[model samples]
Target: MISSNMNVTFENLSDITDDLVIGDQVFTSRLMLGTGKYRNLGVAKQSIECSQTSIITVAIRRLQSSSNFQPNNLLNMLDWKSIWLLPNTAGCTTAEDAIKIATLGHEICKKMGQEYNSFVKLEVIPDSKYLLPDPIGTLKAAEYLISKNYTVLPYIYPDPMLAKQLEELGCATVMPLGSPIGSGQGLQNLENIQIIIENASVPVVVDAGIGTASDAVKAMEIGASAVLVNSAIAQAKFPQLMAKAINLGVHAGRYAYLAERMKKLSRAMPSSPSIGFPN
Candidate 1:
């Protein structure tokens, strides 16, 4: 059980004034960690604590069964009080399956406790090799989930049109992938992502294929509301160190965005004072 005094809605960071609003909830951290692919449970927990993210994602299927249940399981390992759990329907390949998994995710959150409230990260991928998100299945599931009033955040490709469609259907957030899942390619479809950001009324989170801290920095700098990184931290040689780096990168990028970075120049302009300096 979560502690009564634990802070779930906020984490103080003076540089950023705008909070990441998903549905009715607001989060201070722009970095959301995925609770998978870590070397060990201890490492995952340490990494998450280091990241200081308001929410961490867990797959719904893993939490439903008691077969592998133990003290080391994700639920027991997580500090449920302070961290918001955004469960994902990771393995579902069809709209129906995704819906079922999402329902289970909501039920699990309800039973466990809803400090931050129940939120579902909907993923429906049929392809195993590339593991790309199924846009059609995702849309179908998102429609159904929204009807049931679930705070649905659909994982999707960097398709601006699709993003607009999902927003129209009432999804809380639209997660556009930077690259293929776990590939570490880093913003392969930057132009499309930019379009999505430009058009989206809701939060646009850069999800998946973030290879390093720089990748995360680039995402937020390009106007993404937040980033969801898993493999970058979990697969790193030092998970905790990587996690801290990610947090820093996220803050730096968000600060840059909020501070309003300088406009792009068509030609080179001298920073030094040419009138005073030797030619």
Candidate 2:
């Protein structure tokens, strides 16, 4: 139901309601938050509550480490019964590593009584500095995970070709970076992202490099099906308030997109007619 016609008016778009479908699951909120980089789990919880995101991501490594199993445990703090958990292979650098992490994530989900949906965010970033996803490794891992009955959500660069290939490989959703991970660059590669959104058959989620609410707005306005924000909200001075703002921004941008936002004009066009001029 994603249309780029840009021929409709805001008044007529009031009734247009769309759900974000990833694999067999449907989410009402298009803002997908990550459980990382927050001051603490308390802040993360508050942010999650304010964001109203039905889908939240967690690194499988965190879920596996015994250190996080202590008091104020990350997973223990979350209401797993309510929100959908999307475990990611955040630190994985190879397809094999990603596949292994995804498997572990599925097993953890089973142990935690979350077996209804097994969605894993496959991220294979060999580069430590920028943490940008390796498209080849991602594609390889996605294919393997899909075969193993896991709903793969591949994190990748904003390349339309890679997006299509992932979709073809049975990825549930395609997450393209707006900029580098945690860079706060705000869609530096906007043209590429627009292309990804336009061509993707599955949901196009703008992930990483979102610095603020306006960045989220821009992402959704450019036709992103959803936005995956972590550092943007988690690192904010007031994480809870920023989360709320980001959620609202997503809603606004989504509505604007569905409303067939006004086309850009090259020249000025006065709201008042020339005949009604003061002269």
Candidate 3:
């Protein structure tokens, strides 16, 4: 509910550089929005616009022909041509299921766009309570998808060792969760996240568990390449305004990081000179 803009001076603003290059595409906005939890399509579109996010993620599900809702039919309501769709395998638990979902998503992208080239959020969460990503299964899935030549961005816990393995497996990006999915806990493992950011060779996107603009800012301030947030915005009372606030937060975070923050010292300084003078 709070505005992202506060105490930020954009004097030497960082140019929105195309740092995130997935396959042949590059993204400027580090703030990635999820297409789930919005009450309506109109609100989703508005939030996307406000976020200035060129790439947004959406979850895919099998639609029965007899069902009232449709697959691409719903996606079509949005200006799909303007934004890049990153389909996530949210419900997949096994490696096989994840591969199948990736294949289906590739086919769908082919039908939807001329390039037919978009990244996949390869998520393999077995448990329902914690929604923790299965590192072993995730690596298997990422290896398969990367072999298939699909840009893979696998979401995992903030574990540097796991991140190294996934990066070695040829994932386009390694996305680590701030906490649990939709938990809004926000950067529970700051130390591990810093390690991931430090050692990662690829883009490190902090995904899930962010509850506010400040959370997003904190992630970016620590040098995360990007962030993915859904509940903090979509579940808010004013989704559009929340989206704008998030955008500003991301911008503020980016500016702060690029400024290369000053060093910290332990000693306290006296405002007045310590030297005594005759009065």
Tens digit per residue, CA lDDT, model 3, 1-279: 112322334664343343556567766677899988888878877888888886777666642132514543456666666677887888988988988887777766665673567589999989988899999999898988888788999999888999999898888889999988888888898899999989987879999899999999999899888899889889989989988998899888876887678777798776799688677
Indicate the worst ten consecutive residues by lDDT in candidate 2.
Answer: 1-10
Residue pairs whose backbone atoms clash in candidate 1 = none
Model 1, range 44-161, lDDT digits (tens) per residue? 8899989999998889888877653577686777766777889899999999999999878877776557744659999999988889888999999999989988899999989899
Candidate 1 residues lying further than 4 Å off, grouped into runs, are: 1-16, 274-279
State the lDDT at 243 in candidate 2: 96
Quick one: how many clashes does candidate 1 have? 0
In order, what lDDT does every prediction score? 0.87, 0.87, 0.81
Mark the regions of model 2 whose C-alpha exceeds 4 Å error after superposition: 1-16, 273-279
Candidate 2, residue 157: how far the Cα is off, in Å:
1.2
lDDT of 2: 0.87
Estimate, for each residue in 1-279, the C-alpha lDDT of model 2 and write its tens digit.
445432445466654556778888877789999988999878888899999999888899877766766767777777777788888999998999999998888877775579766799999999998788899888888888888888999999988899999998888889999998888889898999998888888889999999999999999988899999999898899999999999999999987776577768999998777895686
Worst 10 residues of 3 by lDDT: 1-10
